[model samples]
Every structure is written in structure tokens, then in C-alpha cells.
Target: MQESATIIDIRHIQVGYGQKTVIGDVTLTAGPGELIGILGPNGSGKSTLLKSLCGLLPYSKGEVLLFGRPLLSMSERDRARQVAYMQQEVQVSFGITALDAVLTGRYPYLHWWQNESPADYAIARQYMSFAGVGDLAQRPLHELSGGERQRVMLAKALAQETPLLFLDEPTASLDLSYQEEIFRYCQQICREGKTVLIVVHDIRLAAKFCSRLILLSAGGILSDGPPSQVVTPEHLYQAFGLQSAVYENYISGQLDIHTYDRRSAGQPGKAIHVIGGGGTIGTIIRALRENAYPVSCGILRQGDMDTAVAMAFGTDNLVSQAFGPIGRELGEQNRQKIAQAHYTILGNLYFSQENLDNLKAAFTAGRLIIVEDSPINSRDGTAGEAALLYRQLTARPETTVMKLDELLLAVEKRSL
Candidate 1:
């Protein structure tokens, strides 16, 4: 292929079985050096699309092009030479050594009736080592663990050394380490100018490793772009009917998903204002939202984890700039929200000079629920100022102090 040329061009393709359409009007283009992830809920035709692109399944409408040529027009050997596809599951009934399985990847290069050469063995061994399955070469496929078998199969696909690689849930049954290992290998391969398209169920893993993402719905592509663009709340809801909070995890520095189900819980029109920061209130926000409570949060910094969770659940949040103290305007806004709420919750949050206003706002609530997982003095970074304020709030007539679990139970009971 020429420089920056498209390796796989799928144009308005529709694939089906026995008059029932599975993939509908899907169009996508992939060039070299790109690692794209296909993500969606089950029965969204992710596997069907992969099979159609490889010409293993017939497309009822539209066409596919490989290397600027029609996919159907290419010979099987030519197609195999250019594309390496790994299916979702491999079942071996007969006994075959792992080494022999990996050697089959060289079939495209060998002519009919041609015997395997020493160079082929070298190439197979090299990829087996690359896939971290070099030691399993002599083991029978049936005797290997699921993870071991997956690595061996991945080595076989890598040994093909094709420009375009299609993997349908290659990490399905693998352990956590093996799943990450496979994605890491794919990342390195993409850097060498090859393209990889993977059907992945783990949205967080795909967001972390894949350069681009294609989100599919029941009908067709819901969104297609970089991870930031494709893994939004709107696209996730449209594709999977999932109400989820998508945010960058502070520790992992990757996009993470927190899903909630609010359908069964009827909306209870009770306003609850939450005061929290430093990632202390994420679980509370989710629990309240899942219980169908009308929730709002305030006095959090712009980049705070609490702010992200509040925004994800469509809460009315009052936020300030990062590293800056809560100003009069935001503090007053939070107080107003707290005064309007039926109940206010103070999460188990560490107090600093910057967020001291959050504790002051809690006193404005008609009824207060204080989540005291840790002692007040332990989280008192304000030289006992916050602890003094917290003690006074808890001493109020309508205040109730409880642990996190008890607080959740109280909220749930109040919802009923």
C-alpha cells in the first residue's frame, strides 16, 4: 500500500443471515498504524461486522475494499496474506501441538504440497516468544489452560504478519493479566504501521489501549472517533441503554465506566444536596441516582472527582476552579441549593482551607445526614476549624450521624 493509504474500506455494508439483517448500513475506513476498537452491547453485530470484512460472511448490500481492490475480487490466498483474523473461540477436538498450530500461520507463503522450511520455524518461534507462549510450544492444545491457548492462538495470528488484523473478542476467557498483555502486544504492533480492529467488551480497557473507537448500536454505528469522543454518556446510553458515568480514573489515568440502572426505581421527587470533594462522594451520588432521587451537589472544584460524578448523573452542581478556594458566589450558590433541598448529606471528606465552605453550607439544610466513616479529627486539615463546625452541625436537632452503609440504608428507606 502507498503512504497513509486506507487498508480496509467498508462502504454502507449490510450483512445478514436468511433474510434477517444483522449489520445495517455500516461504513468505516481504517489506515495503517491505527488500532481501532469495536464496542457495543451484546447482539449489536460486532462479530458479524468483523466476519463480513474478512469475507467469511456475505454482505447482502454494499462492498468492502482491501488495499484499494474489491475484497470479493481478491483470491483467498491474497486475502489471507493481507488480513489475519482471530475468532472469538477456538475448539480443538483432536490433539495438536501448540507449535504446529502456530506454524499454520505460514500457510499463505507456502505453495501447495510445499514442505515447511527452517526459516518458517524461526518465524513461528519468534512470534510464539513475542506472544509469551514460547514455553507452551510442545504442549498439546487440549491440555493447555484457556489463557495459555489464547496466547498460542494470538501468536499464530501474529506470525501471519499481515497488515490488517481483525480480532473478535480475543481476550474473552483470559485472565486480567493476559487480557492486558494481548492489548499491549496489539499496541506495539500498531506502532509498526500495521492496523488492528478488535471487538472488545471491556470499555475501559479499549479506551486505554485502542487509538480509536467505533461504538455500534442495534441499527448501526452510534459514534466513531477517538476514545474521548466515542465513550460519552450519550453514546453509551444510545448503544447499551446504560446510564453510566464515564470519567478519567485518577490512579489509572484512563477512561473508566460506572454504570447504573434507574429504570426499576421510580423517580422520587425529593431533593438531596451533597457536599463533598476529593473523590469521597462518587458512591453516594451513584446510589442516590440509582434509587431515583433528585440529587444536586455543590462546592466542588472543576476537576474534582465528585464534580464528575455529579455531572454524570445530571445533578445541579456548583463548581469552582481547580486549586482555588470556593468564592462567595459559589458558596452562596451551594447554600441556596442546600436550603432548597429536603435533606443534605456531608460525605466522609477530608477538609482543607480551599473546601471549608462545603462544611459551612451543610448547616443550612433542614435535615442533615453526616457520613462519618473516619473520625472528624483525622480529616481536619483546617486546624480543628472544620471539626468544630462538623460537631456543631451534628449536635443540631435534625442532624443524624451514620456510617456509609447506614447512610445508604437510610436514603433507601426514605425513598420508600
Candidate 2:
């Protein structure tokens, strides 16, 4: 049901059109300063929920209240001023300048026949800059890229200066970089004490960015809460008919997911060591940790992922050393740790001359080195020497392009 504490509340709403019911018995709320993401497969009534909450669609049953008052009872200008709704793929037929488009957000504050005040223009300019499109103020709607247009649309909504902003697939057509940019912009807005509700297709991005996630099924809410609590394997299976594995990030302490393919059944293979800077080792650490491996790493500064995971697991197996770039002393410490490991793997990291001494220790110590597909380069003279040693150890493979799964299998088999 509706929550009084929430800025926007929907209580067991049954929304439909004409004689067809699109959503049934749905209820969710967005509290102040919360960024809530609505997620599910297509035709799951996600759009219907957005429409119902925005007062664009009438519900057959239940209630929607904005700050304890009925949605229908609110005035049009008051509602528009308090709520900003941006639908997915909204068409802009005219060749209007982006500035004019965004300035439309001030309509609720202006009289029907009166002109826009200087304050309205200032707000439009501020929002345009905040959305990172100040230079595109004069650009026409049709002249922008898909991502640029999406950002302009967001700027227009933000110009509305509403307490609550609703977006439908705000990052739908954008590339990964633009998708993150949009999510970052939304996060910034939420930080400013505004509540944002967005529909998202990327589950991982939603999990990382949204404070709360609401999952929709056939026509109603299947689950709702923090992403860690709401988006689960069972909920995903129920919504999209897919199996997935959920794990906690060792560093960020957030939920991360990996889909499971039933066609390739069986458990993941053995323990392995990831030897790299702690800064970028978080994902690898969490992935291995979830697979039930006794993982360890070191030669890290105090604030790296290695230190975080070590403290989190408190297994006493993982060791963290001082900060600074890897040098002779650091290499000696890492060498001892690698000597005890079954295998050592490296990611796409640039090797420093100072670190070359350390990598050479792994080679002379007879440690199996598994590197990514990237070419190895070194500022230090030891890389070429280390390469020769690695060549002898992995002679059959001859290349550093081993598939992650295949590499894990080989390690497990050799250890057995």
C-alpha cells in the first residue's frame, strides 16, 4: 500500500486501459532523496506503473498520494511543478533549439499569456550546464546523437526542478560510456535531495547505481527493496526466465550477479592467484571468493582491494604490504607468496620498471604465470628475461590468450 513517509506513494494500484488490465495489484513507493530503479522484461507493466504514478493513466483500484494528498486532487500546475516525467523515446517533431525545449520545463511557473522571466532562462541554463550540454544549447533536437538527445531530455526534466523525477529507459539506446554518464548524472541529482525513479534494462548498472530496485512481473511488483535484497536469482528467473548467480563484491560490499547457462552445467574449477595492484583486483577477488576458493594476494598498499578483502575474509592467508610502486623489497614479499600458490595470474596492467624486479622473482621461483591477451611491456630490463622463463613454463599454450574458464580448468587438472 501507499507509504506516508514517501514522496510518491502507490497503494495496490490496478491500472488498465479500457477493458484490458495491463497492471494488477501493484504497489511501490519512492522516498525522498532515493534513486529507485524499476526493472523487468518487456510487457511486465513497467511503463504502466510509470504512467500510473505520473497520473497519466487511471487505476481501477487502489490509491496514489503525493505527500498525503490524492494525486487527482492536485492542481495541474502544482503537479507539474512537483513531478517531472520523461517517457522513453519521446518524439520531438519540430526543429526546436535544445534551449527552447528545456525552457518548456518552466511552463508550470509561468502564466498562460505571460512571458518567461529571466529566472526561468537562468534555471534552464543552469540545468543545461549541469547535464553537461551547455554548448549544445543552440543545437536542434534532430541534430543530436541518440545519447546526446537523451542527455538533453534529462536536462529538460532537471530544469523542471521537481522534487521527484521519473524517467523511462533513460539510458536505453546509449553505449556503455553514455549509459554510465546518465547513471552518474541521475546519482548526482539524487544526492541533491531529489527523488528519481527510472526504468532500466541493464541489471548490473541498476544494481550498482540505484539505492532501491523494484522488479515487475506479469502485471505487478514481484520484489522491492535495496538492490542487494530485491534483485535475486529467483526473482530474475521469475521475471525473465533465466538462472543467475548473485555474489557480494568484496571491496564495495555490493551485490553483483553473473548469469548461469544451464547448457553448460557443472561447478567452477580450482584455486588460483591473481597478482596485480589491489586497486583493480576487486572483481577478480569477488569472483574467486564466490567460487569457494582459498584466494590470496599481497604487495598491496593499505587501501587497495587486497587489504579490503583480507580484512573482510580475515582468513590470515592473504597478506598486504606497503603502498608505493612494486620494487625489489615488494617483489621479495610477493615472491614468497607466489611460491606458496599453485598458479599466479595477471590482468591487463602496465608493468613498471620498479615492478619488473618483482615479476622476475615469479619467473625464477618456477611460478606458473598466466597473463591476459595484452602484450607484455616493461620499463625494466627483467621483463624480457621473465618472458623467456614464462615461455618455457607454458610452452604448449605459447600464447597468453587462454580463456578464463580454460585456464582455470588447466590449473585444476595440473594441481590434481
Candidate 3:
């Protein structure tokens, strides 16, 4: 890739309508070949700020310099060659082929009576390829799916052959797969020595794809840095009114954001470990965390909401893997973690032969407290031996066995 330069410099730009400043004194810079994602809640002036960049909205204060020159002083042709703006939702108010839509980007270089030269067509085709819509050139905008339409819009922007591109909510209409595809395409665009500034709501997608993220919140620039540095949990909560626990993926080793609906009222006084899967222990983890108990979980890979919830609580003790059938390794690891806990409560989950070893580990460690009737269905598909072992523990003089409600009541009584 070529070395990209700083093509956009907005220093202290205040944008708004007459007598009202929606976004005030904003300063941001986008370098050549940089993909920057702008994030903020609705009505936070993200769109207004973007409009200010293209001279569609007049600035109330400050200056915008394009390639070291004042934006207001640039000629139409010069400005068109430098910047391309793609709106989030493009309406097909008129029936136009995708090719025609893209060809409009060449108007800046055309005379009133002149036909589009072969170079313009070649440029349009190349951009369509760059945006992954070369095959849809003949299709009408109305005939495209949401994702396809978005790509076509992107192709139009790219067709302008500009170093700077602005996109507002480019992935808003896309499904998960399409959302990822669009972001990946944008990354490729940046790699080609073009700077693309986009507004996106999915912080995780932006973090994974964009080189930098600019968080707009509370009428100001909250943060501007690389994704890892800028999209911290604190910043996310502040910017989007979301409370999240950030985690490093056990498999991907990348950052994942898990938003929690309820906040722990106080710091947990004790660290506990949970052992169960198949959505059996998710509520338990939440309850423990809500009651100010620090909890860790493990060995439940995919199809386990428990593992997903554990990530949300920022549980320090999580051992998870991708989706697959439960295996001996995971069972053994879960058993080891459970054995290490100060106390263990068996969730109302059926036992399986595969996980029988995990239960046995708890038995060997003499730490077993089973939820009532957990082993009733154990013989069907679950680990009946584990259930039997649990029954033995409950029957023992030292073990405590209680139902879920009883457990909560006991905790409440103790608190009083």
C-alpha cells in the first residue's frame, strides 16, 4: 500500500442551523488510507457534523481545511475530486440503473454536451469492483436488497475517485453477515490509499474493522484513537448510554463487548466458581453477581448462554471454547474449577456421561451442594453417576442441599 497523507483537517468546526449550534467546536483529522468510524447516539449531531464536512451545512465557527487548503475556497471540480459523500439510506426516488447512479459521480469532469469518455466508464467499473458490486451494474436500485443497495451506494462514492469518502451509517440496514462484509470492504478501501470516514452504531464491528474510532457524545468529542484504546467500556457507557463488560475472547484473543442490563450495586466480597452448561447456570451467575458475589465460570463452550452471561459480568474465571459437543477435556477442566471454589452449587441441569467426571471431581474434593431434583433426568441423557454422587453429598452431614428459592431466601435471611 502507498503511504497515505492527512487529507482532511477539521479544526474547531462549530456546525449548526441559525442561532442554534447542534455540534460545537469539533476538531478531527482523517489521514489518507484511514478508515475512521464515528459513533454516537441519535440526535447527537453525527449526521450534522458529517454534513458540515461536505459544505452541505454551514459552520457557525472554526475552519475546515481540505488538503491544507480552506474548504470554502475550493472549486467544485477540486472538491469533487477530493471528497465523496455516501448517505446512510439512499432512496430510489427515481428509477435508475446502478451503472447510471455511479456514472453521476463523473459529472464534475464532464462538459455540458460531452459524452462520458471511456476512462470514466473504466473508473466506474473499477469502483464497482472495489465496492463488490460490479456484477450488479445493470440492475436497478429498486431491485437490490438492502445490502446490495448499500454496496451500490459505496460504489458510487468510490466511482468519484476521491481520496476522502464519507459514509453515514453504512451498515445500519445490513444483516450480520452483510454488516461484516461492508466493514471488510471498507478496510480494503483504506488499504488502497483512500481515507474513508463512516458513522456506525455497532462498536464491535467498528473496533474490528476501522483503524480509528471517534466517539461523539454529550455534545462533544469523547474520544479519538485506535479502536483498542478508544472503545473502552467506560467510553462506551458514556457515549452510548450502555454499561458493558469488556472481555478478551478466549479463542480469538480479541476484545468483545458484553453489555449488562443491571449493575452490581457493590463490589463482590468473594470469588466463586460455577460449573454447568446448557443455559442452566446463567441465572445463577447473574444472581450471584447481583448479590455482590464475584463469580467465574468455565468449560461451557458454545450453545451455553451461561458462558455468554459470564462474559457480561466480567467474570475472571471463564474457560470457554467454540461450539461443539462437550468433550472430556472441558469436563475435566470444569470439574477442576468447581473443586477450587469456596462453595459449589449444582444447577438444575441433567447430567451426561461426558460430564460425569466433572461431578466426580467435586465428590473427590468433598465439595457438593446440589439443587433439588437435579439428578431426576440424569439417567435419560445426563450423568446419572454424577447425580448419584450429588445425592450422596447432600445426604452427608456436612453438605447443604436446597432449592433455588430456598437458597435465595437463606441469603436474604442471612443479610438481615
Write model 1 residue lDDT over 1-416, tens digit each, in one string.
34558988999999989889989899989999999999998989999999999889989999899988999998889999999999999977557999999999999999999978999999999999999999989989999998898889999998888999999999998999999999999999999999999999999899999999999888599899999999988888888888888877777788888887777676574889988988999888888888888888988788888887788778888888998688999889999999999889999999999889888878788999889999999999999999899899989998988899987886677552
lDDT tens per residue, model 2, 1-416: 12345798788889888998889897776788799999999998888888888788888999998877789888888788788998898787578988988999888888989888899999999988987888999899888888888888888999888888999998987889889888898899888788989999999999999999999988988998999787777888889986566656765777767665443334544445566553545555545544455566654556555555544432224343453456555567676767666656654444554444444554543445454544444422464765564455456342244645565564444431
Q: Candidate 3, after superposition: displacement of residue 197 in Å?
A: 0.8
User: Against the hidden true structure, what lDDT does model 2 obtain?
Assistant: 0.72
Model 1 bad stretches (over 4 Å): 1-3, 381-384, 412-416
How high a TM-score does candidate 1 get?
A: 0.93
Query: After superposition on all CA atoms, what RMSD does each candidate show versus the true structure?
Result: 2.1, 8.5, 7.6
Instruction: Estimate the TM-score for candidate 3.
Output: 0.71
Q: Can you give the lDDT of residue 55 in candidate 1?
A: 84
Query: All models: lDDT?
Result: 0.89, 0.72, 0.74
Error of 3 at 223 (Å): 1.3
Better by lDDT, candidate 3 or 1: 1
Residue pair clashes in candidate 1: none
Q: For candidate 3, lDDT tens digit of each residue in 310-389?
A: 76666755454544345666667666666667676666665566555545555643445566644355433653555466
Best model per TM-score:
1
In model 2, which runs have C-alpha deviations exceeding 4 angstroms? 1-4, 264-416
Model 1 gets an lDDT of 0.89
Task: Tell me the spans in candidate 3 whose CA falls farther than 4 Å from its real position.
Answer: 1-4, 263-416
